[model samples]
Target: MFRPAASIAGLITPSPYTQFARAAYCHGTNTWSCEEACAANSDFRVYVTGGDDSDTPDFFVGYWPTGNAAIVAHEGTDPLQLLSLNSAIQAHTGFLGAHSRSAGVVLSAVQKVISEHNVTEVITVGHSLGMLHTIAGC
Candidate 1:
């Protein structure tokens, strides 16, 4: 169900990182495509990419975007302020006595792909706050 980052990135237009993620990962799919089958049903999206076997270590790339949210189910996850390093760190560490919810979803998607696809490695790609989440997940 992976759609190659280039195809689904438009769901969030003007995101320069989308292009970067696509190029770096070379393969990915939107949340909707990976949702049911991949077990990523979170309101927020954690694009999953991994289907090529030409590479030495077959792996998956989990992509997270900064400042994009459609669900406010988690407390303290403000779309407007997610750009701040503090907020991104807090979200990654689950500072609100709980995570921003999307954090779990994103992590879950990463795990799902790794486990389901027998991935040997995982590359997390993003910009700004996304970089924080990516490092934190590792």
Candidate 2:
């Protein structure tokens, strides 16, 4: 008897990229490769990530060409933005806004993208410092 492929599909998450989009989006040349992959998959060209030179932390969001929602992920503190580490230290129980200014940049972009693309759902992914920003922003 043959079992349906779907029986084992649950163990795997379908992803076209060889690595997580977060890693590709965070790096330099890999970012370009990830963009190419996205382009090939669909006309979906929309992409936003934490600024390389800006004070904001690392954040990434991408949408499928035909999908109405998207998933955003954050990477570790960008080496260029060491101040992010300071902000993280200041993010104590009563000081959530220590980095609100920087976070605003990413938050604003996220809002704009969602509204512009009519995205209805947003799933977030992150690790370490990135995780902190995601939790604080949302």
Candidate 3:
């Protein structure tokens, strides 16, 4: 799946900061701990991060000062999460009760951070299952 850089030279690639943010997104898929990943990205400044693996889905909201927007980072799936551990779950448009609430929390957090920072817009990123929410406009 690896494409040579030379072959992709004509294609527009992600910026340095975009790549950094993706790293944080990937980490969210596996861990709720955003500190290390978010902190390591110099282009982003960690504003606030909170999530619970037991019920709530994990999210990271940070200010992308350079990009003049807030970045909402979410994960796809974390094996440690209770909902993910459940075997009876099935993929559907209607997420479980816990997932619904978690989505609400993530939305509110993104709104609060963007308003507080007065960012022009938000750049959302996710890895794995996280992409589903993003695509669903959640």
Candidate that would win on lDDT: 3
Q: How many backbone clashes does candidate 2 have?
A: 0
Tens-place lDDT per residue, model 3, 1-138, is 133355564356654334544554344423334454544555666655555644544556666777777777655565454455567877564345445755665677668777888887777766656555544554
Candidate 1 wrong stretches, greater than 4 Å: 1-99
Cα error of candidate 1 at position 103, Å: 1.7
Lowest lDDT sum, 10 consecutive residues, model 3, at: 25-34
55-134: candidate 1 lDDT, tens digit per residue: 11112344323323211111112356446656435332333222243455656665665555555544444444334444
TM-score to native of every candidate shown: 0.34, 0.53, 0.58
* lDDT head-to-head 2 vs 3, winner: 3
Candidate topping TM-score:
3
> Of the candidates numbered 2 and 3, which has the greater TM-score value?
3
Ordered by lDDT, highest first, the candidates read 3, 2, 1
| Each model's total of backbone clashes | 0, 0, 2
